[model samples]
Target: MKKISILVTAILALVFNACSTDDEFTFVAKPDPEGIAFMNTFLPSYILKPSNATNLAERFVWNEVDMDVQTTVRYELQASADESFQNMTVIESDIATTNQAVTVGELLALAEEAGLDTDPDTEASNSGTVYFQVRAYAGENPATTVEQFSEPVGITVELVEDTSGEVELPKIYVVGNFQGAGGYGSDWTPADGVPLAASGPAKTDYEGFVYLNVDKPQFKFLPTNASFDGDYGDAGETDGVFTGKLKQEGEKNAGTPDGTGGYYWFKVDTEKMTYSLTKVDWGLIGNATPTGWDSDTDLVYNPETKLWTLTLELTEQVAPDNGIKFRANDGWDINLGDTGADGTLEFGGDNIGVPESGNYTVTMDLSNPRDYTYTLVKN
Candidate 1:
């Protein structure tokens, strides 16, 4: 019995020693790391260059972080419109260097990508500040280290339009058998594609006309210079109007034209991400219409000036509200008239009054489809 008791005590002692042994390691959590500080406290003012600028504008610097261990650190420099960093845009990430320098071009792009603009440049509104901060993480794989972010620094940024004539945004062209010089399915060639007009500094508004023939059943829009990298096609409905927003390298759905195919105006507003296709056939229609609204006098298109021109004679006895109006397709569905008797025409507006009875040369300017204008001069 004594021997048995000794064996049990020895076993208990062995078990106690096993539990006390340092075989299993415990990770004592390190204190939260310290945030970095900007070596250059003030960031210089940034200006957007129309083209790529080579001069470095700002070089952000920060002190190294202490992770309580010898490990390589990865730094992520971030820029944001808000101080809270809710919608943070990382300028640089996974960088071993703590300092980051950006060029004038780079800074401008970042600001614009963040929905910042320079238009209506004013002291109170167009100008503002952007927040810059740094986040440091330790270790290479699994990123196993304490992470800390520096206090945000404010950088005054001035938003301005790039009028240097050196910048041109990506443009979309009408391709795929749009009744141009090439016949049909000519998506691979740039010469055959109809170029769309770009507007605004952002070039988000695209407008142009394409002469489509009835033989071709469909057409699509190419987002590049016939490179065909990103093209947007019919958005599943397969109708003449593709309401779906253009996506890069998206599905190729063709659009069907209406009215046996004619000159169709396409307006693409990237700001709104919407497109409209309208068939335009200008005609003089009203009580002054040559055939009393029964027949229409067509206006020829001038390719050089992008205006509709027509010369006709009118009598002293005015009929339709003492004037006439321009209608598309000889119908009232899309008609334009002068509201203030000014050169500009308002859609579905009042009749443009004639000053006197004479042969007049009327020119309607549709170069900028968003704003239509017309001029009537006595020949």
Candidate 2:
């Protein structure tokens, strides 16, 4: 009986070892994808924003990338101002598809999104180039395989002015006793005040940063550039709410700040007849900033220059990508970045990249809302 049991155990052990040996794994090599080609030809170098049909600009075609494996191959086209494709928008369907076409309207929107000013009325508005590249990958949706990118191709895009006769709104300026005798209110004249420019595309919204040095018991808005002919008031109220004549008529009263003296950002809406004053607290944040994309570092505001300033030393190890952005009140709701990568700051623009790692004296000029500039001086 013992010999029979031993024979059975020996037989089972031999079967297990045979199965394990057969299961040993071996790798299969798959060749990388190659020979990606753009099939579409004669792409328009420059195009105007399309108003109607027949304006479809270009159809991007590329030869299907071939890998040794026989699975599904997906393609994606991306466009960006930066050739590195650090920040890009997918040109065609985000899904696994090929042969994408862009219409004039679509191209214009992409141009604007890429930071080229599309406002034809502005003197700074101009045409610019955008970079494009195609990427091929294999596998299922949300592909896990490595992607191969084709060489980037660039094309120039032109911005067409809007001939729609957009309404031009009056610029608002603020003047008060808080500005002091020789400051914004020197000689008690209405012309000596801080000009409030339009916030964005809205015609009736105005905003600006001002210093209320003295205990400002009163302040008023001038509709004209430097005239008091048409102004606004708070109906003799000491609250932040503003009323009175936005243009050259009506009679309300003057408005006052909630507190006596401090740096403040005033936003007034002529269409809504409303106004708000928030204490300005600007900070820096981003992957390239000293705070490392998470925290905010305060920027000092110079009353005389009306600019936010910050001087800091940056290193390549920490700020590998030379990127930073300005955010107000330690929040992302109100932030500014370089749209054109041309030192001009725009709201919610691209990340501002530093030329090199060094001590930089950064200055943000908000004096002109229509034309904001950020100057970086390396020392």
- Runs off by more than 4 Å, candidate 1: 1-81, 85-125, 130-156, 161-176, 182-208, 217-245, 257-260, 271-274, 291-296, 300-307, 316-322, 339-342, 368-371
How do the residues 168-228 of candidate 2 rate in per-residue lDDT, one tens digit apiece? 3335677767666325647335667777776433245778777777654457777654566
**Residue pair clashes in candidate 1:** 118-159, 234-253
CA shift of 290, model 2, Å: 3.0
What TM-score does model 1 achieve against the real structure?
A: 0.52
- The list of candidate 2 runs beyond 4 A from truth reads 1-169, 185-188, 199-202, 236-257, 316-322
Choose the strongest candidate by TM-score.
1
- Report the error of model 2 at residue 151, Å: 68
- Which number leads on lDDT? 2
Among all windows of 10 consecutive residues in model 1, the one with the lowest summed lDDT is 5-14
Q: What is the lDDT of candidate 2?
A: 0.59
Model 1 clashes, total count: 2
Ten residues in sequence with the least summed lDDT for candidate 2: 5-14
* Per-candidate TM-score against the hidden true structure: 0.52, 0.49
lDDT of each: 0.58, 0.59
